[model samples]
Target: MPPKKLSISRIRAESRVRSDDPDLNRSSSSNRARKRYRSVAAGSSSSNASRYAKRKRPPQPKLSARVLSILEDDMRETQVQNRFAPDLRAERQNVSYRPLTLTQKARRDGADFQVPTLASMCCSIVANCFDSLLPSRDNFDAAAAAAGGRSASSSTAKKPIKNSHTLKKTTSTRKRSKTRAFGAAPDSDGDQQDYVPSEDDTPATKASSRSTRSRRGAPGTASSISSPNQLLAGWTTSELHYLTRKTSEQLRLLSLAASFLLYKTLVEQAPQYLTNTIISTYFLPPILSSSAASSTASTAAKTHVWLPASIPLLSHDNSAAAFLVGHLTSAITAAREYRFTLSRATEEDIPLTVLPSRLSLAQPVSFALRSLQLHGLTRLQDATLARLFEAAEPGPQQQSILRLDTISLRGCIAIADRTVTAICRSTGSTLRYLNLDHTDITANSVSTIMTSSPDLQTLKLGYNEHLSD
Candidate 1:
């Protein structure tokens, strides 16, 4: 087919029509713009490169060979051997190196011993197999003799060939004589009946007999754990126990390294609490139940211990907060229980404080904060305040409302008469000290509080100028 050609005017008309097409204009314009940009960039780069090349720095002047050699010689002479170089072993007389102390020496010695490991077990097994395969000459000879004798005796006697006709009678007579000497009856021809077993003598029974005999000769019994072969396993177990002890978490960090399996085993066995390592010169003990972290206190006393130990960590370390996530209720429960135990354990009212402030740390109860001193509690949502009340619920044995003997609502801007009513409802029966200073409460609610809190020792209704007192 001949190539079709368009006139110049026809081509101009087509170009104008295509220019009106937004798709074609957009696509072609982008490509043209890209090419123009590349060309401009190339030109600019070439010009910059030439400009920089023309302004190239001249070679720096060098000293004559004789001057250079003289200077280097002088430099070498004054070098002083670089006494304060990067080498760590370099020591100065004025600053003596730190000596290894008794503790460091003990640590070094402890680190010298290594556990029998999993990787070396394969080598031991292979070595044992190789030793078994290479038997000594005496053993080989004995085994060969036993095998040959057993095989020859196990075979059945065939009919005598024509060549052996003369000797067959002699052979049979010799076998008969041997069997008779042993006092067993001989077979009709060659005494094969003497070796044949009865129907009751099964292979299973013979195997059982052999096993029992071997067991009697075995080296170890159930109580015999003192063998050298067991030492490796026992040592490994002890080492793992030592590593998992909370003290090891601090001490072993300096020297000991652990594989994943060992690390996992240690974590699984480690206690949930801290332990004291340096007790009576021993590194760590089997357990530290008496330690601050793992106290054996009753639930209430444990809360007293746990709250004091954990609250600081929670305030300072975000990561430590996870350890106390589910224990908030338990802590409150313990506080409530503490009140009960104190009543039974002694005559005095050991004042206690349930957490009245969100940001305050837990502390030991010299006297429970029977005086609930809270700040800005009124700013908290009603639901949150109610939740706090709910959390303070006592155990089944507890009878009194949590020691709300004294409540000082100081500097609370958001409290109302209804809030005081709620507070009075919780602690109304036992309250002895009531301080409603700098609050929004009115005399109307004050009467209700006084009515509920019959045991109040002192009431400071000051700074509530709106009370019209």
Candidate 2:
């Protein structure tokens, strides 16, 4: 084959002949050359076949059941830890607890969003006003005396249970512990409303004796002796505000003074003791006195204003002493920086004023509102203020008692409708603790609150026998 080489001119002559001759056509040879060129360009040459062969995929690592179970447990624990960890800075300090919500933004900045929901504002205002009151030892002694002495002895012995004042010290300590876990410092504005009481862990006998002595006197008798440190006890919100138009001046002064002291104590023991006390007692003079028509042109000397001798101001906590301390410290500082002028007739004279917009809280030190006098609140006017039931989500860093307690608003003020609605909407099915002791709420309110909330566990309706659906 190597000896059969042909010249270029001979090959060209043969190709020309083949092009015209059908029997000698070169189509097959030309196709073979095209295929050969394609194969070389594609890199599919026979020499590279082994190197380009397909490979099997690597197997995936298999996890054992034990390893999987461990992973799941770790995930669960992490979730729990995240949920339980409280925000230290915001939880115990006066901070807004509500996250920025779509509806709130619309309502807050919207000019047309007015529906007369003043509960939160009122609470803040009242709290500030109360904080202004200075705690006086004289007030506590007088109130204790007026409540007919803490001893079980009663002239109307028919209701033996009513006169009993014995309380378990361990129970009080437990209450204090729980409150300490929940309470935080008030903001600089001094608008905080929640208070937790201190625990007096003395023997039950000792504690009862102290309480009895504090109360054993003519309603309105004043005592100079320092009460046992654990003498202060908590009341329901309604009890704190049980004002009557027929109250004596001495009793009114005592109620105011005791409230002031409670505020002082709370402030001093921030992390340990705080209290949310509601004072609802007062004696209101008649706006239109029938006796005025019979008065001879001579004006009678003003009768000593009557105050409640046995006023049982209700509160929603354990002790208010720690709360009082916070307000005292802040007020002292505020008085130094600003000049406050109050009229004799105004509640401000008793230190109850609107809270300031700005606050200067320092570290663990915080402030609270102090109101020593009940201006318009009275027993007969109780119907008016009673009709003024209001509810609000407590400020940030503060826990809402509504979150943990049930609330009944039967005969309370209709004006509280919006506040109650707001609380219901926020808490929904989680409302478990409630105290509607002797309120005048309708069955409708009770049903609505209960039906809407399925989580209620503790309800104090002892005085609210009227509540029915």
Against the unseen true structure, what C-alpha lDDT does each candidate score?
A: 0.43, 0.35
| Regions of candidate 1 where Cα sits further than 4 Å from its true position | 1-330, 333-369, 376-379, 390-398
Error of 2 at 61 (Å): 74
- Tell me the TM-score of each prediction against the true structure: 0.25, 0.20
In candidate 2, what are the lDDT values of residues 60-116, reduced to their tens digit? 233334323433574542332223221233343685565556578677779766443
Query: What TM-score should be assigned to candidate 1?
Result: 0.25
RMSD of each: 30.4, 35.7
